[model samples]
Target: MWKVVVVALAGLVLAGVGGVALAYPSLAATTCPGCYGLTELSPGVHVEDGLSPAQRERVGEVADQAARRVTAFYGGRRSSPGLLVCLTEACYRRIGGGQERGVAVLNRSVMLSPRGLDPVIASHEMSHVELHARLASSAEVPQWFDEGLAVVVSGDPRYLAPESAPDRCLVAPSGPLPVTLEEWLRTASADPATYARSACQVSRWLGENGGRAGLLGLVTRLNAGEPFSALVRTR
Candidate 1:
């Protein structure tokens, strides 16, 4: 009877672990890309099984273009993170994606859903990967700065005016901009204009500062142990 009880307890523990893994499949993708049946199409690029050869080729092209764009914006080259493309919604959900067209998994990888296959979206996600890779820890970076910088780097027209100065507010925010990641996520979920607000603020800062040079200088300062608040104080 004791042996049976012990086995039952072990099964329960395993089941709990399995449940969590199922709910958050990104855990497996981040640590073990092979676990989800992804096929490597090229260096740092992986795709789910259902993508055709043509789709695979498209993914590679998009990834390359995104990398080039981000590199150009930074004025320096950084290694590209792993790119995981999911052609089907099932695959996207299996890899823990929801409404987001794409998501950057830490600084290691970016997962692209079917709708996220566009160059702009890919570049946007890659922007996150690039910034995160530059820092020892992203905890020091404000959520608005991170997200807004990604928008600027990607030139996402949805949030900014076309061919206009970065400081121009394309979409007005419904409320105050968020600072912390938690607050950013909450506001983003509730208000679609959060990205616009963030982009506007960062753009305004860039305009007042030295634009691209200023951004590079800020990153250099952050990397050299300067506090973000001190580097990015209100003028």
Candidate 2:
């Protein structure tokens, strides 16, 4: 009877592991990138199997450009995170991608779906990585500011006017901007234009402050143990 009970417990543990792997395959991929048959197209860029030489070249070029843009905006450089690119829907889903084109996995890596191959999308995700590297914890900043800063840095024309002032509101939000990640996700799903609204508000705030300098200052203060609320009182 004791032997049977031990076997049952082992089976339960295996089942739980399988469940988690299915729910979040990205965790497995990050843990062992080569397990998914990903090949390094460059120093830090990994591509799913079956990607052609031209496709690999494109990914490398786009990632390089994105990194440069982010570095320029931040006025400093952070270590490049692993970039995982999936060229097919199956690969994307296998690596835990959903409706989103791209996602930043903390400050460690960025995963890109087939549709997220553009420079703007890559830069947007990398912006998240940059901010995460700077902060002791991502929780230090609000969700709106996080996404908004990405939009601004990526120069996402969808949310902001080209060559226009960043403070100008383009698309009105459906409601109040979300402060937390959960609320931001819910509001974003309900109204896709929440990104524009966030960008608008952050842009306005940056304008009132010192622009990129203000952002760096704010981050410095946050790192030095200053409250985000007191630093970003304009918001």
lDDT of 2 by residue, 1-235 (tens): 9999999999999898788678778876766678787888888888998878898889988899999889989998775789999989899888888989999985679999999998899999999989888887643988998998999889899998764663466875545678899999998999879999998878778888888899988888898888887877533
The numbered model that scores best in TM-score is: 2
Q: Which predicted model would earn the best lDDT?
A: 2
Q: List the residue pairs that clash in candidate 1.
A: none
Q: Give candidate 2's total backbone clashes.
A: 0
Q: How well does candidate 1 score on lDDT at residue 36? A: 81
lDDT of 2: 0.85
lDDT score, residue 161, model 2?
72
lDDT of 1 by residue, 1-235 (tens): 9999999999999898688678778866866667787888888888997677798889989888888889888887565788888889998888888889998886678999999998889888888888877776643688888998889888888998764563477865444567898998998899878898888778778887888899878888888888888888542
TM-score of each: 0.84, 0.87
